[model samples]
Target: MATSSGAPAARTFFGHPWGLATLFFTEMWERFSFYGLRAILVLFLIAPPADSGLGMAEGTAKALLGVYMAMVYFVALPGGWIADRVLGARRAVLAGGVVIMLGHLSMAIPGGAGFVYLGLLLIIVGTGLLKPNISTMVGKLYQGQPDARRDSAFSIFYMGINIGSLAPFVVGYLGEEINWHLGFGAAAVGMALGLVQYLLGARHLAGVGDRPGDPLTPAERGRVLRIAGTVAAVAAAVLLIFAALGRLTVDGVTVALTVLAIVVPAAYFAFMFRSPEVSAEERVRLRAYVWLFLAAALFWMIFDQAAGPLNIFAQRSVDLNVFGWQMPASWTQNINPILIICFAAVFAWLWVRLGDRVSTPQKFAFALVMCGLSFVVMSVASNAAAGGARVSLLWLIAVYLLQTLGELSLSPVGLSVTTRLAPRAYASQMMGVWFLATAAGDAVGGQVARLQEPWGDVRYFLLLGACTMAGGVVMFLFTRSLRRLMGEERRAVPSAV
Candidate 1:
């Protein structure tokens, strides 16, 4: 292991730096805590009070979950700002770990809805602090490495993600089959274990994320704080006013957050473009990123539904009877993770072998195609289920399989490319920008998914499926321009049309 003096990490763990191993397990546990709770969250929400659940309405619960997921990622902009200007990425990650552990522990308590809401609030803030910064550190670890190697490294990193995602199976089992609080406790324990190991491994990450990349001057700090404080106060006042008027419903809050998810990013993009700090070359790349970001947002809108309407559908429509034994519906959540584990490495190797022969836009196009096809298949399944049939679990499995392939295509590549296109001044913040795509997708997707009630599942699935496929076609048309924009002054970018 390297020391805290910021020496270069020894190349280990299949030619990548030793820091990757430290970060890898840390992320593994984080994902365990995150996905484990998520797997059973909707189930717990819809579960009656008699069953020790919150008993929220299905539409409301799903909306809440979608909005919650979006907000968690949406707040990453500030999280990245905190890292860039105040805490430093390393300390931000540590602070985030502690906060997340506490959040899970809070949820573990058997008490009123306040505890649950408080826990979720903490988790959202904590994840904002951790997720983007940790990924930024991963990119930092590969400073001076080839783009292909970095891309492969991200895929390997994503493997850790999928490995952690496997927790849903165990956590869901405990929550659904036993006590929900106990399941929350298990997630807390997982985060605790991750934190302990992270502390021990800190030395390996010494040079990386050790201090703020762009520390604020004392004058700048004071000005920013004043603005931030004012904004927070006004936001809180509005929320209080809404509550007083009895307009503070879950649906209302969800809709509000969803609108922010759209507007905030638009405003942020304008800020970045005008910030004299962004070089003209960086501006060109950012323009290319706008296109990619839109594609990614669409991809996530479909992919994230795995735990929302999709999870609900699995419970209600899919056959759980196997060998005359019923499996927990949440187990269906594991299929994508399982597939990710099995194939992410294969795709990583394939990308490495191909190098920049294929452009990132082309990859995204393929991913959209896969996403669309998955939904198309899902439409068929939903139709059968609506016709009063407990369709075979294989139907759902196939959807996950297609989605897992699409995820490998877009998610890791998106991470790698965001780091590449980012201006030097906005390094960590750029990672936050990447997560905003997910926030936008989930926010819009949540509202779009609610249409299933009025339009029926078949129509809802087919509509999204067809639209996404059209997005893939449009993506292909822009690949040549995107590649040229990305390749300026670069040796080997993702390549051409």
Candidate 2:
């Protein structure tokens, strides 16, 4: 590793290191591919087979979407470890990009449902490798810079994320209005572009993400490689057997993934809490994180459904007319990203301006409340649909705007807090635990979305909205207790988003 003094000091983009720009664009294009797929996935899954879809039931499609999203995050645990102990972040990212491109190409091929399944699996694995390591590299870029600059760099990086997120509109339109394969091909092109730029800008990365954080000894390396190879072979064989038996149904996979999502996080918590390596103070912080984790899960359960029930609602109920042009339903998914790009700076400014007036727990409470209000807005729209009226697209936009505000309050802060509270020996593990919250949420969210078809839209939206509001109220009441558990060290945690 290069020492701070030995590192290049020249400012390149917006007073940050040149590497920030590299990571920024790389992440931007990656997210473009990711969100573009997300915007069209459920639509493609549920559309008629004659229309280039699988013709899966809405409930089944939502369940699969949820499972797929959960697996994408869940795999990051091993993915991060792989980067730390085997492949360096740079190589992992390159390999992951190649896999993602291949995934998109597979989806673009005109074939049966098998192609979709194969594409999703590849994308999930590729995302697992790319997502966490890229964020780690961004942090590495500001390693020796002033502490304040780290937050700014992350803010810039997030803008890149939203910039990439904007692609869903174009890609979704192509997928929904034109041909699904074209949209998938566009996503492949996006990843290709990102990979090309990453290669070109490799020099800017310098000492960042170039080597494993924890290199293994020769003996340890041999043991790990042997174990990993064995595990991979066993997994492949088991999957093949399952597929051959015709037992690999979507529902079966969803149920299995949901169980893993719950069990893995529970096991992680137990291990961390019981470990002698964790000090008493660290244990208290971990307990606080449990509450934070649950809060995040609830928030995501509602937010992530944008691609499931909410996407369906937009297509079925909302009149997407803007200036005499009918828009594709997937275009509605773009609202949240646009809001994030527009207001991320404002939220950052608000946090700084509020200073000591706000606490982490308070911010979380606010997020939950905002999320509940978003659902409440949706409930109203649902009621309008029940009354046989097509609501304005503004209703869905309002819901997305409110949810984006909640995301700004919570998501980045959650990441910062997870890092701050992590034990030195288990930093990456703690980050994985944080991601598990998202996995759990998506898994549960999928199951919840399944109820939408049977329960009717009005009742379903109202029920979810009421439950989320109650959760926010409970979190608000527990805020002081959570703050106490965080102790004085909570003051050091920086707000992000």
Candidate 3:
């Protein structure tokens, strides 16, 4: 069992206790590795040969990014399956860390394109295994309605993600600016550290990820085989089709993703609509959750830009001056995590104080608006930069603050909502699908990020901000109906007899 860090044990820091610190630190390092590579990813790819890069075109870089992110999130579907049915969450997470470490190490190696691509493949596969399972473990830590502290727990966990995110900028500063392989090497080391800590903490986990030790019943075993077969068939079909078309690039990939985007969710809805297993009201609620998932995806599409175009914009246009020191543009990536740690507590407190009054739908609505608003700041900064040499760093900070608040409102809630709303039999797969939606959104964001304007940076920001706000407004307009559909705010009032 992993020993606690000498911190006092309480009923709930917000709502959870054991395994949090374990998960927190584990996720922290994991994010550190993930985001560290991400921080310098585009910069490295786009950097001039004078700076030792392949000097790939922006469109190609974005396309590669889309494919990379799509693979990462898409693989999670199978990863979640393995966690639920075979390896269990604990082993899956550890295995994922190892895979990621290998990937990062591969990236660290010099002069081998095959090695670099292979490393990316490894990292993507590893993330698929680790990401959803670790999150599943976090959900496992709570049972029933997890009270106000649940958000705080997620916030703390969220901080770990940011803590991990913060390291990349530092690593990027040192590695990318000085030595490219160094950054990749640092990411590998980070994952290795995560694997070690996760193993050390295994004892504290108890029943969390303990898989069913016995051989599966014939029916369950058959179901597993069926699912695996279905997934394999689907993947094979998609790849064969793609190969035949001779169409593989940013546009081709995006079109495929967009066209298929509605299919999964739509199929899920069709299944729920036809199934007799669930009550009609339950179906309504499930449908609402699906919409929430869609809206959440839209929000992430905009917010995720922080790592892509926003990172570039910050590096190029934003002025970072503090006490006679100019912070690297990539360092702005740290701001979101820093704010997450600070506001997580406050947001948790707000929920505690406002219990039952604030609906999940409302939170979702807030997230959408915040995501949209963050883009506006980006637009404003871009516009301002037209006249001036450098826009104030404060604009970047403002955007992060809004985006973080939006994230605080919705992101953690997503895990809880999915676990609560999804059917018992479909828990892990459902979560995987939810994450797959995220992958879809990320793919979209990558496409949008590449489609810059004639006015350069200003056009993308304005379009993104408007689109984000429009999505939010659409959600808000439907808020009452959505609330009703979700059955989220209902209270058992006494009859007036």
Give all candidates' CA lDDT scores. 0.88, 0.88, 0.77
Arrange candidates by TM-score, highest first: which order?
2, 1, 3
Estimate the TM-score of every prediction. Answer: 0.89, 0.93, 0.85
As for candidate 2, its clashing pairs are none
Instruction: Summarize candidate 3's per-residue lDDT along 111-218 as a digit string, tens digits.
Output: 745676788889999998899888878867775645655545676787678778788666787665687778889999988888887888777776788782234678
Order of quality (lDDT): 2, 1, 3
Point out the higher-scoring one by TM-score: 1 or 3.
1
Candidate 1 versus truth, CA RMSD in Å, comes to 4.0
- Highest-scoring model, TM-score: 2
lDDT of 1 by residue, 48-98 (tens): 999999988877887888888998899888998899889999999999999
Candidate 1 segments exceeding 4 Å error: 1-19, 139-156, 279-282, 353-357, 423-428, 481-497
For each candidate, how many residue pairs have backbone atoms clashing (under 3 Å)? 0, 0, 3
